[model samples]
Target chain A: MEWIIIPDKKPDTHVEHIYREKTDKRILKRNPWRDVRLHGTVLVLVIIAELIGTIKIPITKDVAITIMPLIYTIILGLAFYLIKPIKWIHRKQARIAEGAMMLFIGVLIAKLAISSGQSIGLIFEMGPALILQEIGHLATILVLPIALLLGFKKEAIGMTNSIGREPNVAVVVDKYGFNSPESRGVFAIFIIGTVIGTIFISFLVTFSLSFLPLHPYAFAMASGVGSASMNAAAIGPTLAAFPGMETQIEAFAGFSNLLSFCVGIYIVIFIALPLTERVYDWLEPKIGRDSIMPEKEDDNNA
Target chain B: MPDLIDSSENVSVHGIFNWILLLFIFSVITAVGNFLGYHHPIEGSLIGMAILSFITLIGVWLERYVPLDISSILYISVIGIIVAFPGMPTSEFVLKYVSQIELLAIVTVFLAYVGIGMGKSWDEFKALGWRAIVITVLVIAATYYGAAIVAHIVLVLTGVPAV
Candidate 1:
């Protein structure tokens, strides 16, 4: 929490000052890339080891069932460790790392669960299944504050310091004057247009897909493409409710997420960018450029 | 100096109390959802967020009568947990599905960053004229269609079962 404020300072320290500071005998220098590479390599080795160990051990159905949760817990723990620093450093990078970590964790857990003799269907039915069916849910209310306190402390001191700053565009937008009726009308139109366009596109995709002999996986993928969090949450209940389609649904959800990841960046840049620009342009002419940057005029006159 | 000290003390107390309240609210929502058999983790989270947001709004409204500072610390913590949890499936699902979600999250964050970076001031955008507006609309349309097409092809080729 405190680290959030570090970037607000106007550092008088130059590059030379930074270099000199780095050279100080008391200051321990580190290569972040090197650290990342080492961690990556270690993670790879651990994954390989786990895979080989699982395959080599002739796990009985009962044993595999018990080991499944334990393995998942371990992997989850490892994922937390691997992602903690990255999450702190860069949220985007943290996501990538977390994804990889999740994959490994999922595999280890799945393998353990399957080997332990419990049907994947049963686990789905009893655990997350039951949890999902309950609509009016809250996390265990008592433990919430402790968890939040720990998170704040961790974020403040950990990677929060290194995360990049917000872009300047937001500030300018906030400052821009768009009080005129015409400008307001244009702005409203733009929002409505974007929403309508998005909805139309979504509908089209759904309609076209209706013709195919697509798997439930495809549906899940569609859901993911439509919205990641929504799809992710739906998977448990969807799987549990329709037990026969669990594996395929799970697979589709995974693939859909991957596809969305691949496309989301390009879509935002290529699609959202222009739309935002156009809306601004339409409003600007009506509002007048001078009104938008009154501060700039003042500075110029001064 | 004395006034500043007094204000800072007040702010800290306000922050602490707010966090405690948030914790209570989040726990109650999640617990009730669990008890009621709302298995959709995402829905549970949404409920939690909605409740929190409502609470914050109400608190802000009440601030006219009483000086109170909402603690962002509590909000962030709850969000982090919500994001991190629900991926707690039988390890296989987590392994397969979680990574994909992670990748999606990364892409989303990256896109958001790009959007923020490319964002124009209201004045600048206004000055750019109708051509800019047209371009943005086209781009949004094209991207959505393009992604949809790609998804369709992938799904078809993979022989995914129809809903």
Candidate 2:
């Protein structure tokens, strides 16, 4: 079965219906081709960001080359709110772009993989250390029992995996079905992480490299955890850290990222998902179930 | 083409043709992006994009051969490494330009797209409730610190010289 990343469009949130309803209110009411226009508007915005991103500006010692993209994202996003013409069309397209996430994921992984072939030697040298570090990615499961202890709702277990990468989302959707109790948690974190995960990872990696005694190689490896853009963002500062060896650092990092992307799914499915269920069971018995479950999604309240 | 194409999925000729068209578009944009960046020359980015496109296609083809969901990164990277290893026809090209293109430039577009997508979904997110907020906090903290702690230990154990 093809693993779909597009959220099952709820009746209230159907993009086509939303588009049609909005169209009736506008003067372009008769235009059946408005969807194409909406896509074009967002595509133009993306091109603007792309053009601006190529220009490099030095912002302190380690933070150069990335400022433009960040600035563009903020400016364009703000413009969407301030400029009504673009904002309305932008709204229709956001869901379209979001649904096409699988395309971006494939492109990202393929783009990053070009460097993977070159990183094999570095990966072999790093050996178990890299593997062990990646295993630590599973430490995300540590939050399961803790979330339960804090009396999080049952569905909130989905956010236990940060950045809800494709694999994490797949596992949850597969196990729980579309609107399963945990689906809301997964979708919620997925949205937040997708919005913020890349920049967040970039800053965290950069800060850790500067302040901590970490081998830049390790941070390089950590950068490759599933999401291609997030991996690229995180790998940026590590490349900055290694400076002259940017190529070599990327090779190792690229290979590590490939492992995370390729293997991270199985680990989540076979290990983390099951371990989470076990932890939830263990926690409920230890702390009253009502105490652990975060407030459940009550649509009636809405 | 049997191995090359996934029959399990209901793939039509139109689908394959569409993908081919997308590959062309991706290549053109990447090349054009490079030309725009430098102003004077388009040779490097074009050459880089061409190779990248071919390598990426191979990645798509090789996807079926791998065990589990190996996807594009592994197949392309591994094949790229094998062909470009030490001294090969593609080594010089791969070595010079694989990491040369400004990845930031390309990904920035996706970032902006992602932001709008997130904004559009705010109502549904609000529906997830306050616990969603707390859960997000824990998820981010644990993912970062958990990886940090492990990386720290591994570096210490391996005696990797700290920068």
Candidate 3:
């Protein structure tokens, strides 16, 4: 007896071609590492200048403060523009252009902050400013976190979908099942594990620090360990609220950023790679079953 | 046999319940930290998150349960919220010394970017893998001590009162 099997029809040639073209375009455009490097370099320079008090351009402190961020953003934008290898003059031109744009934005933000009576200039002058004014500025610290969180959320969601061939959310849901019994069980386990780990470590660190004769600066450093933003958001406000601690607040702001970078190094080298390797190993066993090396096998046969 | 297997599976914790529990745990920790006279709110929050994570780990082995999905999202969201809300008590003071705060935050974000970017630039650093790690560690240690020294020098030069 003879058996016949019919193959399924191929997908549309045009559709396949379009997808291939799009994929190639995406591959060519992707350069997150390069962008990150440029941004990082600019950030380091800015911090060094601030610490050394060398960023003098004969502007009012408020104006200067407002302008600095603009400078950062502009430099970033210019860096993006001149990403390709260019002559020194052209690169210089791009930097100048970008700096001008950032300056405008910084000035605008500063003006807004000033108009609202939340000027950093006012905060510096140690006088009996009414209770309400002091309290109002303190409130801004709490409010800023909410804004940053919303922005980060949008960016994170967008990032999750951007990676790989398939939408990450869809892939995640399909693999883990959003509402499935198995998925729920797994999710439950993960949450419990993370929470317990977070809590215990936090307790140990906090307890140890409590016993130590730590200055406020030391406390700020401790806060900056896991995530800099959280540390800054949490400690920055407290330092501000405390009387006669403006300098400490400024110092914390400066050091927290530096500490955050150190923490990042620990996370990336020590934490991320090991976790990735374990995940890859776990997936390899299952993936290997579906993949075949027919060419190698035939070579061996010969 | 099927009934026994199903019962075993069903004995695990729920995702939503775990999130709710963790959130509660964090809140309690934060409250406790506050009561204990912890000055910084963010420090309190960190302690809360850390304690909750530890408890969750212990619960995993003892209870044989996990809370995966919701916990990750919650953790991210909480951190995100903390980062986004920048206009706290410090904003005015920070704006005054805006250069310092902005510089710090920017550098931090940059360093984080570099740490993450190193994965892509792995090939570039492969020749000096261990060296790079050591250098990075040294840089961090140096920076910590350097900042302390600089702070001390500035205080001495300016005749600022020691806290």
Top-scoring candidate (DockQ):
2
Candidate 2: chain B TM-score against the reference chain B: 0.68
Q: Roughly what TM-score does model 2 have, to 2 decimal places?
A: 0.76
| Local accuracy of candidate 2 as per-residue lDDT tens digits, B1-163 | 1222222332234433443444444445444544554342456655665566676656654554454655555666677667657666767767676555655444554455455555665566556555555666557656655655676688778787765
Candidates' lDDT values, in order? Answer: 0.29, 0.57, 0.29
- Per-residue C-alpha lDDT of model 2 across residues A1-302, encoded as one tens digit per residue: 24433355543342221121132122122122235543344456556655664344556775554344434653465347335665364554555444333334444554455555555565676777667766777777777766665565556467674447656776787788766667666766776565556656666775566566666666766776666666766765666467677656667666767767667777777777777777767776776346433344444122
Tens digits of lDDT, candidate 3, B1-163: 1221121223223532433343343233233323322233544444433433333333322322344322221232232222222476544433333222222232222222222222222232232223222222222223233333343344344444446
Error of 3 at A50 (Å): 31
| Reference A-B contact fraction recovered by candidate 3 | 0.00
- Scored against the true structure, residue B41 in model 3 reaches a CA lDDT of 50
True contacts kept of each: 0.02, 0.33, 0.00
Q: TM-score of each candidate?
A: 0.28, 0.76, 0.22
**Model 3 backbone overlap count:** 53
| Candidate number with the higher TM-score (2 or 3) | 2
RMSD of each: 22.6, 7.2, 24.5
Which 10 consecutive residues of model 1 chain A have the lowest summed lDDT? Answer: A156-165
The DockQ of predicted model 3 stands at 0.02
lDDT of 1 by residue, A113-140 (tens): 2222222343233232222211101111
Candidate 3 chain B least-lDDT 10 residues: B1-10
- Look at candidate 2 and tell me the lDDT of residue A164: 76
